[model samples]
Every structure is written in structure tokens, then in C-alpha cells.
Target chain A: METTETLNETQLITKDQLLNQWLGQRKVTRRVLDAFPEKELFEFTIGGMRTYAQLTKEMLAMDGATAKGVATGEWSTLDEEKSELTTKADLLASWDESTEKIQKYWKQISIKNFQEKVVAFGQYEGTGYSILFYVMDNEIHHRGQGYVYLRALGITPPNFWEQY
Target chain B: METTETLNETQLITKDQLLNQWLGQRKVTRRVLDAFPEKELFEFTIGGMRTYAQLTKEMLAMDGATAKGVATGEWSTLDEEKSELTTKADLLASWDESTEKIQKYWKQISIKNFQEKVVAFGQYEGTGYSILFYVMDNEIHHRGQGYVYLRALGITPPNFWEQY
Candidate 1:
């Protein structure tokens, strides 16, 4: 493939591996969301933390926008305002939607794109690869909060390592 | 470089890049640790989450052990029981110590070891590469909890993207 043919000597992980990593993290995060009881997800906050519901919205918005931004090199911020999660169903639906959207646009990205620099949301600057990792990394961070929240609420989060 | 000459066609990121990424993340996480107030570091909990101090200890334990395990392939489980952090000074001191240990041992890991499968702590099965990523990824997750905690405490977190 042209992508492989053009691989930089410095690169050590394949694009496929990175994509799978991204998707797998999302799967585990979705389980954590599913584990939440409807009331506590939005209401539970320790030390003035945002509710898991609120944090999940931030993840969804970033995922959807970053998917587009990485594909098109145009970051959109205005439309990604705080979304309401009236129920666990709403949250899960949004999560699945973003995942599908990510897969869809991920096809448009070429190996060249991964190395091209782009300013995400017209603010944070990174290569296509770093930005993608940033989106995935941010999700993990928020998911950790869910873990803490779950434990505090006396529920066990999905094993973070169970990602496949 | 024997390591580079032996690279699998599937690898896309170099070992140096991964190590730098790992270290850069720790740099940012340390900043997060420093930002916490002495009292809040241990005293704060949201919805029953572990305090930042407790969370940091977990990161320190995992980092120190994983460094050794990756270098020696002898995972040590008995020695990493959380040490007392009577103050923030003690915590930062330990964090610095773990960082040194990771650097010293990272030299022992080669491209071959990364692909070699080993069960971490006699339970989690993954390649050296995957296990290394897990340690870095876990820090980000917990560092995020610190972000929420800081925000809840009404302080802004260090810009996460600032990693060099």
C-alpha cells in the first residue's frame, strides 16, 4: 500500500493498531456508562467534580468534532455546546453515534494526514496522529472519573484492561 | 541499530517516540500533582473516589513495578505496597524516584521485548509494548481525576496538551 510504502523510519506502530486501540477504549467506556444508574450519573459529584453525565457529553462532543476535524482539517466548536443526557439511553445512543461517525471519517485519513499539523478546534495544535490520540486519551481520562464515581457509588467499573 | 534493523513491518512508531511520549506524560502528571493543596491531596473525594494522593500512589507503584518488569521480565508484586505520603513533599519525592527508576530500566527494553508476551503481575497478559502503553494510559486516566478534583476545588488544571 502507498501508506506503508511511505512509512517514516521513525514510526513503530501501525495505523491499524492505533485505530483498534481507539475503538477498544471506547467500547470499555461505553460499558462504564451503561453501568451507571440513571440518577447518580448526573447527580453524583465528589469534591465539586462534574457528574459522569456531564463529563460524557464533553467526550461525545469532542469525539464527533475531532472525527470531522481530522478528516477535513476544519475544526468546529460552535455547535458542540453542552448536550443534555436525560437518561442513560440518551448517553449511550450519543456514544454509539460518535463511534460510528469516527469510523466513517477515519477512512478519509491517509498516512500523510497523520503527520500533517492541524490546530484542533482552532486552539490546540497537533499532528493528525497526536490529535487523534488526544481525543482517545481524553476519553480515557474522563472514563477514569467514571471509575472513581462508580466506586464511590459502590459500583465496579468495567475492567479497563478488558478492552478488546 | 540492531533494533531498528529487526523491526516488524507492522510497527509504525519508533521506540524513542514511545519513550518520549511516556516521559512527557509523566511531566504533565507531575505538574498536576504539584497543583494539589496538601490537605486536599489526601482529604478530598468525590462520590467516594480516592483522593489525589491515593491515586498518585497507585501511579507511582505501577510505574516503578512496570519499569522493573519490562526491564527484567520478573514482575514484582510484593514490594510495591503503598508507602506513606505524610506530606506533598514525600509524594513528589517518590514520584521523582519512580521516574528515575523508569528511565534507568527503559534502556534494557528493546524492540524484541516489546513484542514478547508476558503476563504482568501473573495475571494481565499483553505484549511489552501494550503493557507499557497501559502504564502511561493509566496515569492519564488518574491525572484526569485530578483535573476534575482541581476544577471542583475551583482551580484550573495544567493545559494537558502542553506535553513536550
Candidate 2:
């Protein structure tokens, strides 16, 4: 509400720390994706839920592009229509590409820029920090589902807390 | 990172909008909680995964306490190793309390304070904004697991995007 007149210097965190945290979560999520058995990754669903492959694609479609939009001030419409990712190896490769894109574009965003807002993907409008957080959140959300899928298939998932 | 010095006026959104967006996701997560059958909610697990009830409690432990900490500079340690909640209704009631607490404490946080950092729950040091975003992200992540549990139990989960 603007009542706090002076900026609090003690509370500030370096931009590097924030970005690293987000990237750490991404690393854990990629492991979640890899835990899935190849067949189940694309075929397993309970009660009409989408497969882990589909969910991964949904995450892939947004994260890199959203960060790019935030960094460059350009918003492009995305095609939500996705084809099946037939193999786990292929999906993992695509996930690696997205992670690289995030690292590359992340350098373009300044700490002050995180407070700025943008209409991400030509739709939802929010601060750069909020939108980027959504992408990260969305990945974690889907990864949770992947954990469930792994369990259902009688496979143990990678530890959830070992992101770093 | 500060090389692009020109101010971008169009990329801005109010704090209220950001909070509402987070609340909208929380609403859908509540619906996910509702979809679970009582017995399965607490007991169902695959490959030794935590029950959906456990995941929900983990979320509850963080959200309300987090907002309180960000609003004020103090954080109270939560007892995570507590006993069972016993009933679905009781769990949901506790969840409602946490949600209400978030709303109440959110007002205490000033916009400028979001940039300030804090060590949330005696760990995970990050900015107020990043910490709050983690709370929201953690909820979404666990909620995704709930969706999987529902599906595995032969129940149809609510639409994911219907949160907004």
C-alpha cells in the first residue's frame, strides 16, 4: 500500500539466487519425467486424464517461450494442438532443449525487470515474475502427476526434494 | 542485465491482480481435494508414495504461515510430524482455515515488501515474492498428485483449467 517509504536493503536477494532456485526445480522435474516407463509415459491415464507425455508437452509449450517473451518484449500465439511424443528419449531431448532456452534467455532479464508486467502468450497478463513463476509452477504440477503415474506403474519415483 | 535501460510502461499489472490469480488456482485445488473419496484420500498410495491427504497437509502447513511471515518479519516453526486428521471433513475444514488465514494476512503485506527477502520456515531463503510463489507452486504440485489419486480410484477429477 506504499506506506513503507524506504526500501529495505537487508531483504534484497541477488537475481542469481532466484533464477537458480527456479532452475533447480526444473532439474527435479526433468528427473520426474525420466522416471516414467516409455509405454506408460504416453499411454497410461486413469479416469480420462492425459498421459505424462501430453502433460510434458503442455509444460514444454509454455516455459521457454514465455521466458523468451518476457526477455524480448514479444508475444507470439502458441499452438496448443500437439502430436504424440512417441518415445521417452525424444521427449527427454525436447525437455533438454527447453531447459537450455530458459538458461539462455534468463540472462536477458534484469532484477528490476522481474517487477514489470507482460501479457504472456497473448493471453494472461501479470508481472514478469508472476508469469515466470507460473511456468515453473506448472512444471512442478505436472511432475507431481508423473510421480503418481510412476507409482501406479509399480515404479519408484526420484526423490521430490533433491532438486539441487 | 541492466543494459536495456529504457523503461517499459506497458508491461505492468497491479498487485491485486496477481493475488487474485493465485487465489483462482487455490480455488481449483480445493475442488481437487473435494473430488477424492474419503477412504482413498487418506489411504491410497502406489509404490509407497505419500497419500493425497499427506500432500494436502504439507501444503496447509506452509501457505498460511508463509503469508504471515512475509507480512511481518517473524516465522513460527510448524510441527510437521503430527498425527492423522482422521476424517475428510476435518481435513477440508482445516484447509478452509488456512485459506482464510492467507486472505487475512495478505493485506498486511505492502507492495514494496514483496521485493524484500526472508528465510521462509527457517529454510529456503528467497525474496518475499519468490517465497509466496513457492507456496502457490507447492499447492499446484500436490494438487496434481491428488488428481492422479482420484483417477486411480476410478473417479473423474475436475477440469484443470476451470480454476480461473
Give the interface RMSD values of the models in order.
4.9, 5.4
In candidate 1, stretches whose alpha carbon ends up further than 4 angstroms from where it belongs are A1-11, A43-49, A72-74, A82-86, B1-12, B46-49, B151-156
lDDT of 2 by residue, B1-164 (tens): 23222322222234555577678888888888888888888899766878888888888788889989999978988655446677888778888898899889888987656777798888778778778867787788779888777877888888876657
| Residue lDDT tens for model 1, A1-164 | 56633443334455755777788889999999999999998798866767888888888888977878878987887344455658899889989998998888887876667656899898888777677777788788889878877887789788977887
Q: How would you encode candidate 1's per-residue C-alpha lDDT over B45-154 as one tens digit per residue?
A: 77776789988988887897887887789997733447576789999999999889988898887656765678987778887767877888889988987888888788
What is the TM-score of candidate 1?
Answer: 0.81
Where does candidate 1 chain A have its weakest 10-residue lDDT segment? A4-13
**lDDT score for candidate 1 against the true structure:** 0.79
Cα lDDT, all candidates: 0.79, 0.76
Regions of candidate 2 where Cα sits further than 4 Å from its true position: A1-18, A72-85, A107-131, B1-18, B81-84, B110-130
Provide the TM-score of the second chain in candidate 2. 0.89
DockQ of predicted candidate 1: 0.38
User: What is the Å distance of residue B31 in model 2 from its true position?
Assistant: 1.2
Cα-based lDDT at residue A12, candidate 1: 43
Give all TM-scores, in the order shown.
0.81, 0.77
